[model samples]
Target: MAYKYSIGHLTYTFNDLKTLLARATPFRSGDALAGVAATTYQEHVAAQIALADVHLDVFLREALVPYEQDEVTRLIIDSHDAAAFKPIGHFTVGQFRDWLLSDACDTAVLKSLANGITPEMAAAVSKLMRNQELIAAAKKCEVLTSFRNTIGLSGRLSTRLQPNHPTDDPAGISASIIDGILYGSGDAVIGINPAGDSPANTRRLLEMIDNFRRQFAIPTQSCVLCHVTTTLDLIEKHAPVDLTFQSIAGTQSANASFGISLSLLEEAYQATLSLNRGTIGNNVMYFETGQGSALSANAHYGIDQQTCETRAYAVARKFNPLLVNSVVGFIGPEYLYNGKQIIRAALEDHFCAKLLGLPMGMDVCYTNHAEADQDDMDTLITLLGVSGCTFIMGVPGADDVMLNYQSTSFHDALYLRRTLGLRPAPEFEAWLVQQGIMDRQGNQLPDAGTYTRLLGGIGQ
Candidate 1:
């Protein structure tokens, strides 16, 4: 079999794909396919397969996948894996063709096939889908995995207490966390990215979070965002570690930038699971990823940023992370360019990650140099809310005092809950009512004396 290939047009011979199609039951030239010939349809499917293979290949290396520049009407493919994603090898060309040509292809049945296929197949078929179509597929996905009811499930969004500080001071960190809690955030987990990567700093952060948990009886988990090795070290030292944290990338070299590998991540997963430190259960991993991290680390192989980002989610899924957030706009403008690009990338990341069977969230933010604003975040938050996003970053006043950037703030969490009629996780909501910040019916109360004292203590 002769095979042809191209870079400009990005074509591949796909002889195997052709053979796969030829062996499938022939499609009668009926009204379903209309005038589409069997051989022609075979070539079309083969071309799509080839394209997806090439696209995923590039995505694996470059950490970015470019959409076709020319305007084209795309098919709206759905993902079926409501609970979890199935491997791509489970389906054959015949099943894919049948779903692609079906009249009722827009429903859950086809969407399952769309998501159940391998990343390569999904990438290929996704080329035929519009952005809105992708979002629709994600909406049908319902992931219920959670530690202390932080993530998974639908109708509720969660928030992480990113209480990072310049000096890794316990007081500063606790103050930030207290503020987040006072504003009705941090139901997701009290996860922190420490200023220093040393085990001492990591241990101090973990101990602070644990102390606060004991002091306030906050029903949540904790993690210090450091290398998996550093976290493992802290775990060995008997530092309170609720969740193991790591920054994962799509490719080997990029992941190596943080000195991580698939084996190492698995080791961390096993080590954390052995701790049994979770308030809810033993799913104790928290991973953070961004679209440009691979490229920044000089690890991208010309793959598109979105694909690279999704590949990172594959790593996260391997460990069943309690929380996996794509810090979308936090990586800056070099990869995504501006707010328009950021919004598209944010939705694309959420849609792809969710379909891949990982609990997904967006850190709806942008660096100072990026072309974005709070209103841009507002747009993204609303979209993610409707799409059933797992959670969002909740800092103080949309600004990470330690990180020196603006992101979705605790106030934004309230806006999303009030506007979308979404509530916090069940345990967090109950905590709110107990503190008199909200009623049992989920209404905000006018007078909450604890809130006043909290504000006075924080001097806000």
Candidate 2:
């Protein structure tokens, strides 16, 4: 017999972690102040470097411990994972400042590589050419993505959550997401993994998005920011949801049926934000440029920039909601070919194209990781919150949670917040855990009573 059909979709993400840590130039006392007088710039640069060092020391330590065990570590892990691992990457103000002063990059090698020589340096050039080829080959080799900003997450993006495992019931999975948000688990975001099922399972998607706020039991006011079903139900079933829900059409499903390209996307977006006084609902679209990037980059079916730019303007006029970016490799081979281009078009040109122009407020997306002991965790904590994106949503591998009939990802959730700058207040944190929306160590799954009480807390 054919499969009994129920869930919306199954999102398949190819783990491509070979990007390697963004090499930083280690701090050279004189490097930052080289242009300025040593006397004048010394103290300023020194102070900044010192502060970063302190943070690094603390950050490194925190990266090693688990959330419940460490106070500060939870914040870092939570920032990157509270919700999802956004592909956009987290770059904090402090991180940026440090990125400048850290001198983490190896300048000598960079300088040697930049300056070309001949004859006498012919041997060097040959070796360099071989090295370049090696680098290219390394990038081409698909690897596990480490969590953003983690010990070595930059190029090696390993996810804190387990990516390989059994899936959960659609609504049930969504319920866990809402639990994270309402009780304030990670980043107050909802992740809907229709994989390719939502459009087919329209009703499920509709109910999930409509009941998004209710699942968390957070007051409507507190329910301002969230992510949910990509079903057009915001326009079709219920009133268009506020900035809370970030709707993304499934990869395989967003095609001829719904015209998954940017143009159709923006058209639907504008329609949702029209605000039809009695006839229409509020116009709020969570703006994310990269969501479609991989689609366009994929040689097989990615949308063109021209079309993407048009959709960007249309949504800007109507104010688009969230943008759940795409990973570069999943769609095709070219690094910038699939997902990267789509993101640039939506976020870069789309913003510059129209008469009114699209606004920033973006969302980055990525996948799981493995190695990245400490540095990567530290990095993700600083990078996930940058760019125009506000909330990050990603898959919570079954491995991230306790083994049970139902699957979840406490690690994924925790990693998300830490990668960014989000830190949940301890009181609320304790309250959420006691509720059991978060998995506790047990061989069994969450009971009906636990689910019921958890959902109850969301609305109350």
Candidate 3:
């Protein structure tokens, strides 16, 4: 169906829901590159205005990517809860945005509405929201998940100690891990992205981290960001696997590009469950997504990148993941052109994922080529911290040697925690205080001897 709205003397017509959504999206380079972006600023605003009057139920009836062609679309349509959607069934997109910002949408109400809200609905409303509105609405919805430690707790911010090494050297990776732990990071998980995907090398990396975790009796999890099939092989070999990791995308074809299927993911989830590695809780999946993945893989099927990115959350939520993050700026300038675009995409991803009931985190990062810097990252991290993000990356000095990008440093996590009065996960916080790395008041203790002891204890 064609949707039309007038701006001054011009009448803008969107031929379909997908076109409407693409045109209404805030200016990002990926859509422009894909030839789906609005051609002019007036057309963009007109599309937004036309979209606001679209009834919430219109999304339920229309699948942006046809239900027959995509499994992701099928999953979304099949899993929707009509009964839960009944309360706000009558609201238009604009009214839904208003309802999200109103006092009526508390945490409990948001939780009840999770099953009812489709990814498209979440994406649609997000396009109409400002940055602060996205933050405010997301702050009210709490998504808690756990493996060895609880994440997404109120007043708690967690960090993924990403100790990635270019050569997959155990010594260098171990040093980064030690650095992160002393800074009160790694409560989310000490995940490594190995240089190679060899199963033997993956096993070595996993065993190395697991041994260190056990030696210190750390209350956290360990993951080597390898393929799901390799991790599944390691699980069969009884390697110490705490969480199954995968880089997922929104469309079936896009995930196929990553060599993963819904059934394969389910199989991995079940295989990891058989080990029973978690102590606190059993949410055992970790997923990473980015905006331009589908378009990059040539599988977006004409939908905008942001909406396709939001659909990936449906895939994540189905697994009850411990950590699900959007590596927002990692896709570079093509998807998110600059610091402003990166920041907007990060906030939108967090809000849409949280609303869909996933424990959302952000890899507030950018490639060297992107028009962004640590200053932009600082702004993004502080905003996410205030929005109650589940976690952020804690790389060494805001740089990933293996991934070749600028991410949040361990000190950046500390800055967010200290500035916003947020603490680490409860279990990991206790361990930090017990080790004398931090004080009872959540301040890092300035003790050189304590640091010396931690460094000395690394190998033993």
Candidates 1 and 3, the one with greater TM-score? 3
lDDT per prediction?
0.66, 0.30, 0.93
Q: Deviation in angstroms for 251 in model 1?
A: 0.9
Off by over 4 Å in 1: 1-116, 446-448, 452-460
lDDT of 3 at 275: 88
Query: What's model 1's TM-score?
Result: 0.77
Model 1 C-alpha lDDT versus the unseen true structure: 0.66
Model 1 over residues 1-460: C-alpha lDDT tens digits? Answer: 3334454664435343322222121222111122222255545554544443342222222212222320000101122242433433433433443344445544355435434433434434444445565567667666656666656657888888787788888778778887777777787887887788888777877776777666556677777888889888877888888888888887667888878887888888898889876666667888888877766787655444454566676677678788888888877776666777787777777776766667788889988988788888898888888888988988888888777778888888888888888888888788787877777655666665876655454432
Clashes of 1: 17
Better of 1 and 2 by TM-score: 1
Cα RMSD for predicted model 1: 10.1
> Would you give me the overall lDDT of model 2?
0.30
Error of 2 at 113 (Å): 36
Tell me, by TM-score, which candidate is best: 3
Q: What ranges in model 3 sit over 4 Å off?
A: 448-453
Pick out the ten consecutive residues of candidate 3 with the lowest summed lDDT: 451-460
lDDT of 3 by residue, 1-460 (tens): 9999987788999999999999999999999999999999999999999999999999989898889988999999998999989988999999999999999889999999998999999999999999999999999989988888889999999999999999999889989998888889999999999999999999999998888888778899999999999999999898889999999999999999999999999999999988888888999999999999999999999999999999999999889999999999999898899999999999999999999999999999999899998889989998999999999999999999999999999999989998999999999999999888999778888777767776666666
- Candidate closest to the true structure, highest lDDT: 3
Which 10-residue span in candidate 1 carries the lowest summed lDDT? 69-78
